[model samples]
Target: MDPWLTLAVVAGMVLAGTLLLNAIGARVKAEPLIAIVRAGLQLAALVVILKLVFTSMWLVLGWLFVMIVVAIVTSTKRIGWSREVLAAAGTAISVSAIVTVGVIVVTGITGRDPQHLLAIGGILIGNVMSITSVTAKRLREHLQESRDEIEGMLALGATPRQAAARFRGLSVSHALIPTIDSTSTTGLVTLPGAFVGALFAGSDPMDAGLFQLVVLGSILFGGAIAGTVLTQLLGAPKVLPQPPREAEEETAES
Candidate 1:
């Protein structure tokens, strides 16, 4: 693709998206454009850094570590930072990345080279970060919205975890559904990035297909582990009572 053409098309697409969002009263006028610009800048920097990173195993490991830390921080911020949220998000993302990549490496599903490791590890870490953030945030929202029901369940002899089980399951399902749908529709509805990239790089069709399969599997595996582990770490919500003023107002009305 010509560089000028690429820039023109991207600019046009961004403008179109911005206009559509504005027309829909999305309330985010400039955020989408800003995010795109930021992403472009980040990718530009990554391209430069990856040149040196791909040459050294130690550098690749260090890069993965940095990715993990950024993932943790991003997830923690998204889910509302606190001691417990930080601990849960950090542990979930780190463990999921390690386990997912370790399995792929041990099974020889992907090459053990630094480039391969970075590619697969980066994908898992990124997906796990998103999964952890969505799962944790959704569970928190569910618990908050269903506070009365959860409290009633607690009063009825249900354990806190048991009371919140429905929300936890829903949150996990919500987090995993997009990945599951994407995997299910692969090749039929969409050509995944990994597969397309591999093909573009002149890999064999079979090799590209296999790599896409591995990537899809890794995404699901990492996401599931992150969601489940974060749920366990989160345990139960502490359902605090209504404030004194609200309680008295309700009492007076009753």
Candidate 2:
């Protein structure tokens, strides 16, 4: 396919989707086109950065660090920023990513390729970031919604953790459902990006399948760890969780 033709096709598809959404009265119209444009720009930049990153081990590590920092900041923004929330989000994401990646490295699965390491690490970190944010947000919302029940439990001599245990479990489970469902239905329902990319890069079909399995397992492991750690850290607050605007104002006041 010609490069210009490819670009035209993508633009047309995005425009069609945007118009369809508008016709149906959906809230998303311009965003699809905007997102496709943004993705194209980002991919172009990433191709240049990746060439340099693939050449140097230090660059690989640095890129991974940048990704982790971005993940932490993004998660914090989603869940509300307090000193405590920042610390918890950072810890959950970092710990889960490190442990998951470390196991893969030590087992010699990714071999001595820095590019591979960065790719796997980035995927795990991104997934963990999403899971941690969802878990924290869900836990906070549940806690706030059940404030009276929690307070009653507290008054009945239940510890904070005890009072919030049910919500914590619920939050972790809710946060993990998408990962669980996707993993369960991988080939039939969805072709994961990692798998498709591996095949596109000329990897053997078996190798690509194995790689996808590893990627999926890493995501599940990291997500579980992240959700559990984050909920444990944020679940039993002294006061109930506030909405994002209120939390932002409170943070500003403090």
Candidate 3:
């Protein structure tokens, strides 16, 4: 396939999809077009930069740090930009990513190659970002919805953590559902991109399957860790501030 021709075909397909979506009242507002343009530009730049950076371990680590920062910014938008939120999400993502990637490197499952590091680390960080965002958002929503019950428990002399435990559990569980489902349905319901890409590169089927399993397992583990951390950080004190003493007295009187 001619590269230029393939590019033109892809651009045409994107335009047609955008037009059809607009005609159907989808109201996406040119996002798809913008995404296509951005993807092309970013990939082009990355190709040039990565070739040089891949020769040095420090350069590769720097690139991974940049990716984590980007993930943090993206997650901060979905979650709030509060200090606690940033700390929780960043710590969760960084820790989970390091642990998972470290295990892979240590076990010799994936070598110390910069290309492999970037690919696997990118996926892990992205997954952790998503899980953190979802956990934060859902935990906040749950706390809001269960305000009365939570307050009642607080009024009965329960600590904020105790009061919000149930809702926290619910939020973390909801956030983990996607990862769990993907892992459960790996070969049956979905052919993951990693597996397919490996096969396309002429890897043995068993090798591809094993590699895919490792990726899936890392994602699931990282997501669970991120979700749990986010939920734990979003206790009642973070979401529901304590009322003034006067207000508490008035409520008690009522």
RMSD of 3: 5.6
lDDT of the structure predicted as candidate 1:
0.88
TM-score of 2: 0.88
Off by over 4 Å in 1: 240-254
* Candidate 3 lDDT over residue span 42-136, tens digit each: 98999999999899988999999999888988898788788877888888788888888888889888657887788788888988898889888
Number of clashes in every candidate structure?
A: 0, 0, 0
- Show the lowest summed lDDT stretch of 10 residues, model 3: 238-247
TM-score of every prediction relative to native: 0.91, 0.88, 0.86
Itemize residue pairs with steric clashes in candidate 1: none
The Cα error of candidate 2 at residue 183, in Å, is 0.5
RMSD of each: 4.0, 3.4, 5.6
Model 2, runs deviating above 4 Å: 19-29, 242-254
